[model samples]
Target: MTNNKTILVVGGTGMLGKPVAQQLKVDGFNVRLLARNPEKAQKLLGDGFEIIKGDVDDPAALRSALTGVDGVHISLKGGPTEADFDHMDHIATRDIAQAAKELGVGRVTILSAYAVSEEKADTPESRSKLKGEAALKSSGVPYTIFRASWFMETLPMFVQGKSISLIGNQIHPLHWIAAEDYARMVSKSYQTDETLNKELYIFGPEAFTMGEAMKIYAEYAGVKVAPISIQMLAVLGALTFNTEWKGMAVLMKHYENWGEDGSPDEANHLLGAPATTLKEWCNKRYSQPVNS
Candidate 1:
């Protein structure tokens, strides 16, 4: 039972976006991707998707990719700089919304952080995301904004070779969701009009603090968990000009300041709750034999 609807996925080659694109294909939608590197996307996605060579920065590219698509799913991420966030998260999103509106696209779905709100839009990324959400809302295109919790997939990022560094006093409990579950929900959103023009909060089955989550990951990966202060990370980032370090520091601080907010009741009731646990995700992720 294949649906004839074509869905264009922006950021289809990314960590989260990849799964969403895959799930959309699995659910029988005619999947398309607007990729900056067509060859890379073809390599990553292989055989099924219609890969259009384009970048989000190009309005013409956006318009071209959006043409004739029934729905578009945006899963973009920006950098360690305010300018980067403004350009990618805010401006690019605005451009896409405008193009979708003009092309008469059926629906637009986007992934957003759980804590992103106008009042808590202090950070550059948060502010930009808020603005982007506003852009889609004002564009008169049917949109679904998924405010998602922390992903279990991000745990591997903390591992530096043999050790895992836990940054900041991240005591906030987060409903760490899995990319696979989130992807399924995103695909499901396009199936029904009930999800259109709505903002949904996506949370996992269990809640765990950053430390607790890392502990689980550390044990599974056979690595030691070490604490790193946020200030120290910031200093290290400044000294080395490491954008990833700086970005992590900023993100940890943001989460520490404003923990996960919003209820996942609506999303759960509508699209079914996320069933994957961190331990379960880790087991599957690390199922392959590793060198000791």
Candidate 2:
């Protein structure tokens, strides 16, 4: 069924992009990844796939990178200037969109965010994503946007001093996901039309509060722990981050209030299966046999 279709994976050298690119290869599609340094895609090499050296924002590089590509996968993360987001998102997305169209790419799948809304249309992260989404649509290519929640891996942040931290009561809901799930789904979308021309919100099966997530982590670690609250602005400043651990901090800001969605039903649509629930996640991920 593959017919050796060439799928161009932009940012395939990234945390999510690399996994998605790897999965695409597993599913029998010809993979072409875009990288600033083709060597960075080192792990993805030697599989008969091609790595086109370039940056997403560079036209000459992108034009060459996109040659003969049937579909495009964009997993872009804005830079520091996106801390104010307004100028970065749309412009970069526009560039990518224009390139895809010129290359005659037929389908485009953009990995987006779950809580991104029109109101926060100005937050550097949210706005940038929205712009990316707009760019894809405006480009006139068939598209799919995977709006995802927080990944389960960042659980380490809540666990400082080998103990999980808490904000407010331990009852605030937490929206979670695994990066692998997003990668697989995005890769799968290319092979199936079920996800075509739509913006899908993907999530794990259940919701855990900051307190609940930490509690599970603690229970898994089987250590003494308690819930505590911190000032919102301070937490915001740290979570929104301007330092080395900025990624973790940025993620925390989104989860600071269990995200913007209360219902975890988004997974029922695009993926057609219940996302992994908190209990299931805890048992498999954290609350294992301790030695696990």
Candidate 3:
């Protein structure tokens, strides 16, 4: 079925955003991308998408992108600093919602973390995400907030050369959803008005601890998993001046403290549950030679 509606995607070039943008196009919606680098977006997304040169930071760019669009999907990620999260996640989402409200957009969908809550809004990222969700809610525009669990795709990130590092003693059993599954659900949400103005908690079919998931991935990639203390990671990050490393340390610590809350029954019933298992994902992802 073809959708006559046009949807503008913010942060289309990111790891998670790319799949949703691609799926929206595959689902027959007129997909437009608001990217900071149009050429890079074109290179990654190819033809078939309307690539607009702009980012969420620019209100003029956001206004231009929101104009005449049926909906806007926001999938943004911010950094190691508190200011970065406040600006990129919170401020950008607020700006986008305001623009969508002014333009009379039909829907606004955003990606959020499952752990985000008033009590758990201790970290900058978590606080920003919670504030962002509130911004969309108060914007008076029809909205869908996808509070999703951890992604299977992030497993590969733990691998550094032939060794994989486990930052914390993450005992929580995560419903590791695939990017494809999340993207499919995002597209499906746009098809029905019933999904509008609701916060959906997306989860995968199988549950596994971070260590368990890493074991499967490590076996496939011919790597060994080693436990690295959070303090050690922080030290390494500080010594190497790598913000990503420091950020990962902070994130791992957060997850170690808080487990995934809320039920996925609503999201599953509405948009279909994610069925991809860790082994299934590994078979598809690491079927060939390991990259790293």
Candidate 4:
């Protein structure tokens, strides 16, 4: 494996992907984004990096993206059905892995969720992520898979009419990491040999229950805090049955049965730095003007 400074980041235009690409560029790597709109990506990334016009699902596009790229970073947002997961998360990642391997790319890193390994509570999203991880592993390409906890950025979206929806009444330890901190971890993973062939369960420096987290956010946003009961959650689940809503319903059911809980000690030890705390992230993010 010869050293090539160029790295290709799939899904680089997404919420999590944007920060990873930015950090890689700042770290002096020749960062290239495989996006549908190269012009838009170039505009977002400024003049520092390149953007290859392509879709991850297109084999030809992936092959072109792999050319002259040393390493590859993959992160995908989940879709609703099994077919959606199959095409986007599983099949797309497999294509990227296969292309990167054939092209002699040195490393491949995947951003996955912490609960993907729980077979008892598997959803289409989790199953798809596992497939993606397996694809990279089976390709014989050195890989790093990050199973991260919830993103702190998603908290605001749950705020509706002064109430935060809860899957259940039980309070569970939720280890929430900021997208920026996660991106930093991903960039660092690409820089060292230490993370090769590793499946890391990464998380935030702090843990909070759903109520505790929502209360903090409500206070910051100057809104009264209240939790939607399990009965109401059931009603909402029944009312909205589309792909996105259906997926959330399934996940919420899983959380009701099992809890979102973890410790970041090992991940922090490996990364050599602590992640941003929930309070810190909320304060910083909320202080700024909310995105339209």
TM-score of each: 0.97, 0.79, 0.96, 0.89
Once superposed on the true structure, which residue ranges of model 4 sit more than 4 Å away at CA?
1-4, 229-241, 260-263, 288-292
Residue 72's lDDT within candidate 1 is 96
Give the Å error, residue 42, model 2. 1.3
Collision count for each candidate, in order:
0, 7, 0, 0
lDDT of 4 by residue, 1-292 (tens): 2234998899998888888998888777888888898898888778877888889867788898898888999878867778888777788888888888899999999888777664633777777877877787899888998878778888877777756655456466777788888888888887778889987878777778777777777767766566555556556657875455556666666565555544556667777554578778767967742321
Give the clashing pairs for model 1: none
For all candidates in order, the CA lDDT equals: 0.91, 0.68, 0.90, 0.77
Residue 79, model 3: Cα distance from true site in angstroms: 0.8
- Candidate 2 wrongly placed segments (more than 4 Å): 44-48, 83-88, 157-161, 164-172, 221-270, 274-292
After TM-score superposition, what is the CA distance of residue 123 in candidate 2 from its true location, in Å? 2.1
| Least accurate 10 contiguous residues by lDDT in model 1 | 283-292
Candidate 2 colliding pairs: 85-124, 168-229, 172-209, 174-208, 205-275, 205-276, 239-249
Q: lDDT per residue, candidate 2, 230-255, as tens digits?
A: 45534555766744345434434544
Error of 3 at 41 (Å): 0.8
